[model samples]
Target: MKTSYVSNLAIQTAMRMTIQQNQMDLLKATQEQTTGRHYDVGLTLGATASRSLNLQREIDRLNSMKSTNSVVTQRLSGSQGALETMAKAAEKVRDTLVTYKGNDAASQLKIQKTEILGALQTFTAAANTSFNGEFLFSGINTDAKPLADYTATSAAKTAFDAAFTAFKTANSITSDDQITVTQMQDFIKNTVEPMFTGTGWDANWSDASSQNMTSRISASEVIESSTNANTNGFRMFAMASVITAELMDKNVTPEVRAAIGVEALQYVEQGIAGLNAERSQLGISESRVKKANTSIDAQLKLVNTHVADLEGIDPIETSTRINTLKVQLETSYTLTSRLQQMSLLNFL
Candidate 1:
């Protein structure tokens, strides 16, 4: 009787130990399936979190770059349009000046002057053109006006209001001369140039020179003389000074007038070349922006892929693993239930 009791006690103890071991194994398997993380305490949580955060930061950086590129592209497109208008206006001025010189009649000359002045006013307005409320040609000083207002009777007004009105057939000239090439240039020099010294637009000026006419003209006397020579305020006085004195004199022969026309054409050609160069430079910048955007997009895609690898789980694989864990857990519970029914009498 004593031997049988001892045997039963030893068997019961062995059975309990086996059940406890199975329960612990089942718990570990369930945890693995539910969490998809291996049971390990040595894994570096800080390092994993830092890597994830870094990828997110990179994604944010690329997004910001894309936004900046879009703005620059828009600005560059508007600038291209403004440049085209400027080139067209400069060409028209040259043609009109040539035609005016060809005709010996003072009446015709006055008429041509009126037409040229009107064209100049139109060009000046265009030069002070804006994109999204910011002046396109005002360098980096978008807030400052590129052209100053010149009231018709103001001391600085050089062009005749009567002539401009006759040409336009409308009072679009208003009661003011509006603005002139010289004043506009001066405004750019003083306000716009400094802000753009090391920027893309700075290359438009000669050498490292400031856009200021005073610095560019060098000789104070010559600058003053050119300014005084401009009887019409809308005239580009510095450029106009290139025309020989012999060609400008009212008493000069028809031959001299022809010569002056040729010189004026040359000057116009030079101005066109300069504007074309600027347009080309803008084109290059636009191209660089496009390339940069493409590169940024590629980087963002790579980051996204890496992030998915880190955090995103495959649904099919996860489902399969969970089902396997459920089966194992159910089998362990069934075994534990059968063990509870076992006793010395059942064994006998």
Candidate 2:
């Protein structure tokens, strides 16, 4: 009887252990399929959650960079259009100066000069352009204005005005002398030329060497004299002066009149060339930004995929696992319950 009782008790205990073991196994399996925790659950969750947050932050950063790049690209396109227009205006000035057709030609030259000056002012304004209120062409100084106002009476313009005044004063000039033929020639060669070359007032301007302002003039000395008929300077400056002088003397000679017309055209043409070069550089920078955005996007996609793989559950696999575990646990419980009901007499 004792032997039968011991046998029944052993069966009951065995069934109870089986049920508990099955429950533990099911829990482990569920964790593996769903939560993916073969070891420490808390640590795994923390790591995965952290990684997800980091990936999301990276995506946001890339998106911001893309937005900035878009603004820069649009601005560059506008700059290119402005430069092309300036070039066309300059070409027209060149054509007028080459013809040298007396009063009619001089009149046309004056109109072209006005157009060229307007174009140059536009070009300078474009150089100081901003994207999202941030200056694009000021190099590392993104907040700094690339071009100071030439028309402003502020400290920024003082240096330029002072330099021009010095040259005029050196030539012994006041009022009318400040606007004389010789004075105009000197101002263009000394003041205007230096500003473009990034030597005088524009020395601190960004990308000075790359802009190639000085290279536009084939000969610096020839630009000052009216004798150099082959160079554009003789035609550009001399013609503008002649037109100004023509306001005083309508009988200005054909030779003097033609020279003035040509010089005005040449000056504007050079400005267009410089602006076009800057536009090209801006285009290259825009392309680089686009490439960077693409690269970052790719990286973000990769990280997100990794985070999903680490943390997310597969519903199909989890369901199958849960069903199997349920069956095992139920079988163990039934076996234990039957064993617990058994006695010595029943067992015999």
Who wins the lDDT comparison? Answer: 1
Runs off by more than 4 Å, candidate 1: 1-46, 149-256, 317-348
The positional error of residue 212 in candidate 1, measured at the CA in angstroms, is: 14
Residue 37 error, candidate 1, Å: 16
lDDT of each: 0.51, 0.50
Q: Write the per-residue lDDT of candidate 2 for residues 122-223, one digit (tens) a residue.
A: 544645555556554544445666554434453434554676567658777665323555545556566655554444434433332122111111111111
lDDT of 1 by residue, 1-348 (tens): 355333345555665676577567557556655665443322424458677778878888778767756777777777678767766767776777766666868677656656555655565566567777866655445554554333355322332223233433442433223433343333334432232222322222112122311111111111110011111122332143223221233444566456555655665566666666666766766676666677778878999898766655555665676566567657656765776676667878
Q: Which ten residues in a row are the worst by lDDT in model 1?
A: 222-231
**In candidate 2, how many Å is residue 121 off?**
4.4
Residue pairs clashing in model 2 are: 235-262, 235-263, 236-262, 236-263, 236-264, 237-263, 238-260, 239-260, 239-261
TM-score of each: 0.53, 0.48
Scored by Cα lDDT, where does model 1 land? 0.51
